[model samples]
Target: MNNLPIGFYVDNLYCFPVGPSGSQRFCYLPTTPRIEVLGNEVKARILNSDDAAVLALQIVWEADTDTIEKAKSEIKNRYPELSFINLSLADFRGVTATLNINKNDKVIYSIGPINTSGPDMFRAAFQDTLKSAEKEAVLNAFNTGESGVITIVYDGYLKLNEIADAEFDGDLATEIKALAPREVEEKGKGFFSKKHKILTPSPSLQECKDAVGKAIENKSLIIQHKDSANVSKKAKDTVIQEIINDISQCVFTKIEEVGKNSQYISSYCCRIKKTKAESVKFNLKKSYDLVGTISESRGRDIIEK
Candidate 1:
């Protein structure tokens, strides 16, 4: 198996020097013999011209499982041809390679000195770095205009046997659940069933008073209400009376039923006199629940010089 071409294997492990400051170096045997470096750590692809086979490698630094899964879903949806493969450090044992940075800079990169502290110390760091690179590559392909044609190699250092034992944090699970799409049930209602329109809640007395005050300050008032055909005439008169009592200076300049009978009620367009007083004060605490009977009820200042 080791003698096969690099593309024959689903994954290949290769290491390049981090820097000259690191210590401890050695190479062990790979489970399979085919090894190749297709590109820089950001993006690469192993290929066998004779076999017409290729395997893509993408590096990202993300550790969150949700993000990785989402990226995988997006990539699969967009490309559909490539598969994502996550790699861990344990997949490859002792491996050594000589890399030439430039004409003058040559360095030896190794994986596994089983008896030494180097592999243990660098394993976590290497895993994190690889994960980061994979995440970057995945995001670049998805978010930008780049083609989503690569199969991301997940962190290979993770032991295959231990994968089943790994678990995501509870918060991450909760977040994923929250983000997942919820199914909305479709209800079959009888033709005569009471169909209710979603209406905004009625304003409290304090809120109404504040609106009046604002209208007074702006020198105008425009009261808008949907036609409440369901509400009795007495109730509509009561609401209009309450408004008049609260703002004594304001007069109903116009009232019209504009829409068809399907409209719940007629709309009211009222004009109020602008008072020079610093504030308009009113102490009516009665609750009208106006919006409860109608779909829309709002008061605004329609400035008129």
Candidate 2:
């Protein structure tokens, strides 16, 4: 079994708690991978040597020196066909090892160092790093037309610290409760969120009269003929008169011919006598269609002209 390709191994030398007070320390030396339980400081069975180094770190964090030594001894006795080197996290320097199974079989191992403050932090960082390394290694092996399993092993011990619960004073808690609830700002969907204005079609003639009356009171009116090919001079003059009769005041400007397709159209710029602000106060119902028709007929380019 030892002659078969094993997994990757990473070794690190870090301080370990040795005594009851958890202060007595030593440089942890992990030779074989093992399983350990947290808090209870229990060393479980030795894991297969092919296990990942990050996994070993989990067990190693909870393991004591004697347990680790015994596990190492057992591995040596059980798998004499396999050979491994003792590496420390402190001395880690991108070392790689290869296990020779037979004339045809070989497994490669990449080792590295992890700098962490405590077992909890180490566990999180080690898990992320190991996952990345495993992915990379598998991809590399596949690219080389090779098949192999990735095993990570880390040798080191991290001191476990008891996390304290947070406490709040009675006055502070009361103050917090007295604070007003924060209002959540509505966020737009950025480029995806759009306010589309659904324009109503032109209103009926009666509706147009009402809207024109209101619009003239507040807003200036600008009317321009758009359909040069279809609209006649009589139609234009009739429309302008209809508007003038409905509005309180109307001023008809000079007609200007536009368009190059032998299509002549006139523009009638008129203004309401009321101030812009007062004109806005006029509320007319069902005037949207008339306004829409006026705006659309003028065409967007008409503003520039």
Candidate 3:
């Protein structure tokens, strides 16, 4: 049987990295990052031992009986950091890959060598009655899904490009005032005491207002539905049945449309002020480091000069 396909996801760990100028032989530990707008603290635990720049990932996957062996072998070889168990049965739930950053502006790139196993609900369901053949047949037929998370211990943070802050209350005046790059000023004097200056700022308050207004407009949620009362119906006993003359006239088209639109609003925003975050300025320079495990065969050491 064909092995199940792997889905992808990025367990976001927002950061800002300040690496050593030019080039350095070592990566520093990453610090806990705080959301600048909301003041929410994201504590990132550092997981490095001695001098090896380590990245530990605890991958809990679900695979069926036929594909379990292949999945385990692939994971074990791809990520030397995971210490997986001897069990093959079930399906994957989700997917994705990842890397971490710190506040000081440096990207730490490496993977840990250790895979651990956990109790899966599907595998444990067949406690004592289902025979091995029955269990194998059942496991071979189901599809659960796969997902993973990498807890970064190395000290780093990520500074992404400044997009609109999504968290600000949809107040035009308030966002304009907060987003202003500079402020109005005054100096000593009473009547003529205080010297007032009119600062014509670039991207004036009106421009700021328009920008925020547009951003809000772009992120607005809209749902469309048709009223059922308008549809001519007949009272068949206590139930209302549509008196349709044509069999092709669909009734739930509007409902299905609404459901489709709802899918757009399914997930929350990121890094957009009130949302989670990502960026184009966010660079990915480490090659093979994020996915491969520590190999003694390489025999190359990266230490400070």
Highest TM-score against the true fold, candidate:
2
Task: Please give each candidate's TM-score.
Answer: 0.14, 0.17, 0.16
Report the Cα lDDT for residue 127, model 2.
29
Q: Estimate, for each residue in 162-199, the C-alpha lDDT of model 2 and write its tens digit.
A: 11111111111211111212323444568777554332
lDDT of 1 at 102: 15
Report the lDDT tens digits of candidate 1 across residue range 1-305: 22211111112222111111111211121222111223522232323233232323222221234433443344345435434423222223232221111111211222221221223322111211112333333233333323222211111221111000111111112211222233344434887666454433333344444555465356454333322112334544454445544443221111011112212322323332211111111121111111111111110110011
The global Cα lDDT (0 to 1) of model 3 is: 0.25
Q: Ten residues in a row with the worst lDDT in model 1?
A: 162-171
Q: Write the per-residue lDDT of candidate 3 for residues 190-236, one digit (tens) a residue.
A: 66676676543334334543544454457542111121211112211
